[model samples]
Target: MVLAGRLRVYLIALWIVGSGSNIVNAAGPVAETSTATIVENVSYQNITALPWREADHRFNYGPQSLQFGGLWLPESASADNPAPLVIFVHGGCWLSAYDIRHSYPLSTALADSGFAVWSIEYRRSGDPGGGWPGSLEDVIAGISHIRQLQDFSVDLERVVLTGHSAGGHLALLAAQHNDLPSLDAVVGLAAITDISEYALGDNGCQKAAAGFMGGSSLQAPAAYEQAQISVDKLPSTVSLLHGEQDSIVPLTQSDGFEHHRLPRAGHFDWLHPQTPAYRLLINRLEHYLPEHTP
Candidate 1:
């Protein structure tokens, strides 16, 4: 829970009001559903400004030909060095409008803090390029790819999955089944955590979630189920960080999510950035991950 993390939630909340609500129609030929064709040699816009010390690629389940890239922060040789891996997924409400470029800063920050980082970029929504389960597939692929690489410097055993907004939603959705090699922890930063509540009206994000899910919950029950970020899907030891004032994806989303979650599933830490609660939450997180190392 960094100071910037709190600021991010607050800022996105303000934009939720002004953002227009409209579903984007398909743009080009729809890419194969569940069939991910990796765009090879594709360079990510290195927005981190941090010197890229080292990077590599591994296709978890998609085309190995695609040249996807990610950074690797190796642990210190000393025994005291922390052994943890953090994978960051970017948020764009499942649209191509946003990409991994925006997450570089956060990845860099995590790397500087001694945690190995993987900032992923997946095919986004709006037809042609990507949509629906495609984004979810890519996320699973990215994590699996990392796991398949035997020589990856980061400790796969202590891995933590993290995301902001839509990425947060995906992170939560990913946790539902305990399917992928079993992540140690899941963290959502002001994530789009609840689908049913968000789609009730016409805020920009609500509209995006509705369209991304392919219609109202009633019309697309299956799609809604697939995209739902309910607490039941979350891991037993998940960590969620959000500003109480977040408007884009209201804080209530997190509240509503926990409302239905089984007590044994997990407990959420809802921190307000405007108060001392933010620092306390981060302190708890720092210890929480280490304390709950499974």
Candidate 2:
């Protein structure tokens, strides 16, 4: 287990840079952060610096211009032996400022690690058909459309939905609806669960929550109520992961939910494959969906 785990770090680091960065203590289970440190930082730019692969194919799920997804398949994937799917949704404070390109590295890394990945692109708060429930509707439609795609080699039975930041908020909301397609689990990475509370925060990302909702919690109480999510209502199968050092979405955003908190990780750490936080994410995926066999 140590050998395989350490090898992944080498492979991903080599791809990021000929850096060959090695994790010092990569044996046995990941160290238990029995009493983890909780920090806060504002810098968020790691994955943006790395070279990432483009998706193998792009498919549109709806007539709207922004409703589409990029599909990445592992080299070993074939019609006879399909790979389990990980549907990725990105976060840009629910705005069009941050698109799906930044997440390519994540999808690419996951594909290289032997899973089929689909990084979804949806209309954002700034777009015509985006904002509020519409952005979420697109995510639901995009996930459901995977059932109709005839080109990809994926095991629909072994699927997981995961999103970051605003996208994570959408994923969690979609999971609550009965219409969403079947999934092994739903993962929220630094998700903003309480719209009203988050809007009160000072960060740019936190302030943008109102724009996505079209008004402040007090201005649009109904919208905030409709969008709010509580841990008590979520299924045990849904997993939450957050970086205690996250600057954008506070770790308190994950409060009430059973989660894995990476003490040393920051917000963007989840996107960079080389970070220990990313390792925990991979471990979570493996726990939820193992390799598919023909």
Candidate 3:
């Protein structure tokens, strides 16, 4: 096993901590169980800046340099006692500007909670052979390679596929394919489900849909059609997690699909270990792939 490129260590539990002191007032109606105060500790810059542990191991699914992924096993994990696996995809509007490193905090948090996380690094829009089918293909290869993953200890039966933002879109696209092995669940954190509509938005991220897709929906109708998700074709177990306060990708993106929203959370709150949104996500994951105790 290769040593982590960054510091590799265990993370502490991030349960609900602040009660009255840290609570921030959300403008609109709060969700049923919103612990909004947790948003204080989570933001794109905040999460990426946190002192997080790197993956425990690294492997390449393809020859491309960007085709590699990192694995983070839980403390109790071993070949004799395999931990469940979570395949992670990070989102940066499908741009090369954002890399897999930003998602380490989330992976580290999941590993600490007893799941083995494999965060994939695929080529992005600005990179050669990246964007559209290439980006999606890399993600598919990363997930499919797990069937042949060796040395690392993981429960294949309990595997889940998940991604954030653009990554979520790819996760859903990949899971819907017939070639992939059966998965326990697929979760999207603030995923951009409707790409055609997203491409028209004025926000910088929304406009990036064109960059990743090669053009506006009008210019590349086929790519847009292929990239847009069909909710009916989704897996038996799927969850769309959106943050109401998310300005990067609007909560409306989750419309027409069954989803859960965090009232006080911004997009990055879902990745921050200390946030209530993150806690709820871990709870949802447990429900989908409960720790196998024999």
Best by lDDT, which number? 3
lDDT string, candidate 3, 6-49, tens digits: 33322222211111122222222211221234453265555654
Q: Which candidate, 1 or 2, has the higher TM-score?
A: 2
Pairs of residues clashing in candidate 2 = none
Better of 2 and 3 by lDDT: 3
Question: In order, what lDDT does every prediction score?
Answer: 0.55, 0.77, 0.80
After superposing candidate 3 on the true structure, give the runs of residues whose Cα lies further than 4 Å from its correct spot: 1-37
Local error of candidate 2 at residue 256 (angstroms): 0.9
List, residue by residue over 1-294, the lDDT tens digit for candidate 1: 121211111011112122543332222221221112212111112122212222334232465322254755643412444346777777767776665654544454455445667777776666454667777777777766656644655566677787777888877787776657667777776677668778885666567776676678899888877787767657777776665445566667677443221121111122112223223334543554463235
TM-score-best of 1 and 3: 3
Q: What is the lDDT of residue 111 in candidate 1?
A: 51
**How displaced is residue 242 in candidate 1, in Å?**
1.2
Decoy 3 TM-score against native:
0.86
Compose the digit string of candidate 2's lDDT tens values, residues 1-294: 111121111112111111223323221222221113322332344455444566888989999889999998888788988888899999878888667876876787788777889888999978998998899999988888888655668888888999998889988887787777788999998888888999998777887889999999889999999999866566568888998887778888888887888887888777766677777888999989976445
